[model samples]
Target: MIEQEQVLDALRAVYDPEIPINVVDLGLIYGVEITADGDVTVRMTMTAPQCPMSGYLLQQAEQGVRTVAGVRNVKVDLVFDPPWEPSMIKEDALKSAGILTDTPANPVEGDCSTEK
Candidate 1:
């Protein structure tokens, strides 16, 4: 049977071309679902809807999930409803990238700063 952890482990190998961190640490992956028959479905979003590497990144993610031994089928879904934010990134990843900082109660207030 396909396991979600294995799928996630596989996905951790995928990295965004523009970022130093892997997709998992970047929080690009929203969810992963594996069926009894070994089919896998992944819900994810890109850092930006207009990102030039979106197609390549999605392809990489799909290929990564397919690397799991028991995954017979793989599906990657791109969603933008909730959107991606700096806060979505894992704390460790952010810290490693030197982007971690205190987040304001109202994120929209712009307390977070990005280093060009």
Candidate 2:
């Protein structure tokens, strides 16, 4: 039987072409469902609805999940109900990508820097 964690681990190997972080860390993956017959379904969304890499990313996610042992089939569903925000990004991934902005010492000074 395939486990959800196994499928997630496989998905961690997939990254957005324009982003340094993987889909999991980017919080693009919303949910994972595994059937008794080893079929896997992934619910996910992109950083932007009009993202050019949408199709490519979906294909990558499907292929990535299919690599998991016992995963007979993989399905990826794209959703945008909640939408994606910068805050959804994992702390580690954000830091690594120099995307997490730190609070400025003085709000009026506007001294925010992207570098951690």
Q: Estimated TM-score per prediction?
A: 0.82, 0.84
Tens digits of per-residue lDDT, candidate 1, 1-116, equal: 88788988999899888898889999889999889999999999999999999999999999998888978889999998689998888999876876665655444444455323
lDDT of 2 by residue, 10-53 (tens): 99999998999999999999999999999999999999999999
RMSD values, in order shown: 6.7, 4.6
RMSD of 1: 6.7
On lDDT, the leading prediction is 2
Tell me the spans in candidate 2 whose CA falls farther than 4 Å from its real position: 101-116
The pairs that clash in candidate 2 are: none
Instruction: Evaluate model 2: give its lDDT.
Output: 0.90
Model 1 ranges off by over 4 Å: 98-116
Q: After best superposition, candidate 2 residue 71: deviation in angstroms?
A: 0.5
Candidate 2 lDDT for residue 85: 92
